[model samples]
Target: MELPLDSPADQLLLAGDQVLLVGSSYGGRPLAASRGTAPGGDAVGRIAPGPEVPKLVLRTVDISDPAAPHITATLEVEGAAVDTRVVGGIARVVVRSQPASLDFVYPSGPSSEQRAAEINRQIVEDSTIDHWLPSYALEAGGQQSAGRTVACDQVHRPASFSGFSLLSVLTVDLAAGLSAGAGAGVLADGQRVYASPENLYVALDRYEDVPVPETAAPETIPATTVPTPTAAPPASTAIHKFSITGAEPAAYLASGTVDGLLLNDFSMSEHEGVLRVATTVGAGRWGNAVADDGAPVSESFVTTFAQDGEQLAQLGQVGGLGLGEQIFGVRFLGAVGYVVTFRQTDPLYTIDLADPANPAVRGELEILGYSAYLHPLGDGRLLGVGQDATAEGVRTGAQVSLFDVADPADPQRLSQLTLPDGWTSAEHDRHAFLWWAAAGLAVLPVEGATVSADGSAVAPFSGVVGIGVEGDQLAERGRFGHPAQDPTCPPGPEPRLVPSDDGGPEAAAVPAPPATALPTTVAPSPALGGDEAGAGTSSVGGGSSSGVAPAVVDSPWCQPFEPPISRSLVIGEVLYTLSDAGLQANDLQSLATLGWAPFA
Candidate 1:
């Protein structure tokens, strides 16, 4: 039964007989607020459901053997429940109600469906949820780094249509510092629409507001008169993307295997004239061949790809022969035009494309069990991640590793330091392990990582880590689920791998160990910053521009890793996910998609 609330309830908790709560399964948590309409006026409220059962259908199971088998009560509810269905294991709860006095806001009492529809509409219309232009810099020669400056008339409008989010993208081609022209189109569900070459730039949000030609009442806005586009301040432009994964394939033996989107996920980024992609590939049904196979005994390789909206190239791979997957984590190390891949276990690889047509593995380094993320130091080194393990089977813990790849082929593992751990709030542990078997590893670089007050420090690019890597070595760095943070870590006296779905008898419970987070501050050193070299040309969006000084673009942030439903391929800047569902191109940067083209 649907519980009456401000709108559609994201989660429902029914107590007394059998308690159950439903919510978002991502990060094992629910959204902050799920708006809905009660039988009254308009309203907004935080998502919360108290221990009150509106309705319950009970069922009984007849059985014997008190310890092994027994009869238990069960209740089933109707309608759409929270995506999450966890019993007594609930962690935190939050609830909010719309002020009664605010009822005036809605003259027409919206139905529950209407409220849900409106809420969805608002989500889709929010084009600037967090949009911004990155900072850029100028350089000699008409040629410049793709991220050097923002297009004078470039505009990005992320809107929602249907259940999908659509980005009405427009960019202006600038010759020197002036507009060459404008092009525009919609980017929705793997599709891209753009303007012609002569009309290099297409104004976004602006085009959305253009009044439609008169025809009594226009159903949609016209293709003109959109508000003049505004530039996204540097500070407002923060980087967010995946850089690593957990559970190394190398750690697994012939019979060992792991299935996790935690590390080695695929991602993409754009360079001066090419687009790049990076991803992981471990054991699936035929992931890697056994040692004695007569054939090539093909090994699974995690690779990244790059292209120019058409042709593609494989730029990097990791864990080629080892049990772990390769290219688990990938990042576009600015300036050198290299894509860095964090290994599932040790020795990270950097694919340098100084020669775009013939991109080669330029750097390598030996470190810990796996790399959660990697940030370019800009000069020539990288800020890498070393993860700790968690009780839930996830290798947790965070570490900062510096690598000197002045010579990409001979990258050196410089220093590794485990960061001090702690939860963001008093209510949280030193480090919040939200997912089962999920060891969090997202690095937030401070200082030297440049950006204007607006947050757009677009430049030669440096200082940032994404997520994912291996599990074999994570144990050495730190234990997962230290009892200090979670008493449940150690189960009674012994430890055993618990089935991710259910805790069975064969599974021995082990004692929990102590876990911690890394320090946010660190001393600035040559290893932290790449070798002192020319900053190189940088652009805010893409292509050439003037009036900007060369700077380093910080790495993007690590958002939650949402495993796609198919096999994915990353080569250079191009990403291809081969799923029964089809193939598409993914943006490596903000992860905001550009478009997708189908193939046979």
Candidate 2:
């Protein structure tokens, strides 16, 4: 059963037997007249306003019956939803609201004629100082029957400055079917957002130019001496923390702005009451070539901050990490943090955060390429998904690295897999990569060209690659993709025989083309069988010398012509892969199709 709504769902989350869907709806003129307003101006002459303001809608669905989900309830709120996260029965959503439009009142009636002229005169005569003041002032007239009028200060101003927008956080209780505004804050706009079960962090970038000092030089300066120009300070990152606990909803707890800019939301992590931020300072903002200091600068640093009352106070900082390089990945686990910075080479740095007041870099390992996303594999091992690079730092394709960090002071890359001309969504979005510790399996959406025996790249395929991690070794289990279908070409006109130019006997009529059969559906290639020794039998470290060989599967379904895989997750022994086309469930062990749910 398909249940259609007014708007397409943009995001969804499942909790128990319920699914929450959030979408946007749009309708009315943005600058329409208020209720009971008299239309005096030339209504016909004015241009029509644009589409109505956008509103966010939340729909709750009961999915007890997996085959036929039904909408249980819905709630609407003004503004567009930016980001949302659901923890248990609580849903935290961030919405951005902008003023409809800026409109000024025009005078009407006989007595108001003279007042209108005076208002125009004041607006034209106001100086710069007065222009900075409020545009209008409200005053009360008479005692018995009070009347209010607004005195205009400026006749015109930019629409953007005339009104202000708001960034609001709202909390919704799915079980109680109630929602309330948690808190409101000011931001020029919103960017990437990060949230945990108990805290929400918003990263905002800030730029400020250091003022150059004015000085007078001496009358006779030495010809051999040259004065150097002062450098400007680097950009800063302001992280605002909000507490999302309690029945009252979330509220801003504190904000800490440090010198540098974070790569993105993934560069921040909070653990053990301390927030660790990995940022690249000295690097100009928005990809500017040079910093405000007027020099090419690049330096990575990690700072630790702790909550102090209602504000976050900086405890300590470690700098000079991967100097001249930018940060690529950051992961915080317990009292340890891993940072990947790269330019010509990838430098994976391990920072000890156990002492927040004095955080220090414990170890550093230099590798050929960099990891854009880092995941902890428990027991002091880290999994990295990024790109492979040459000695000259030329990125070739996607690569996965397994690191042994049991000894923080001596981190080593246990094993690395290089997929030539290949890429994975996990490099940019960590959620795309799934790891099952118990099963010793990691699945990643891999797309790339396969090299043939003749050293030619062929048979490009898009699908999930299952890598089995046993102890310190890595083995390729198999690959799975959607089914394929033969191509279809439009029918052409029937062939007709033509006489020769010499006017000789006409050439025999071109034989009618043989009737062709309809194109047949092609089943997807089967997954490679596991090695007889065991699953993930490839040895990447000292454990097993006989490594399991990778399996090759050829299927047209792996081409880009098919829907791209967007997300993947594992539940029990079933692996679920979602794409624009639909959801596909596969057996975790063999990568065989189990079920499918097509989008309606």
The numbered model that scores best in lDDT is 2
Going through the candidates in the order shown, the clash numbers are 115, 3
Top candidate (TM-score): 2
User: Considering only N, C-alpha and C atoms within 3 Å, which residue pairs clash in candidate 2?
Assistant: 232-293, 462-558, 473-540
Against the reference, the lDDT scores of all candidates come to 0.29, 0.64
Alpha-carbon deviation at 243 in model 2, angstroms: 1.1
TM-score of every candidate relative to the true structure: 0.29, 0.70
What TM-score number comes out for model 2? 0.70
Candidate 1 at residue 451, lDDT?
A: 26
lDDT of 1 by residue, 431-522 (tens): 21111113323222211222222334332222122222232111111111000011122222234466544555555445443332211211
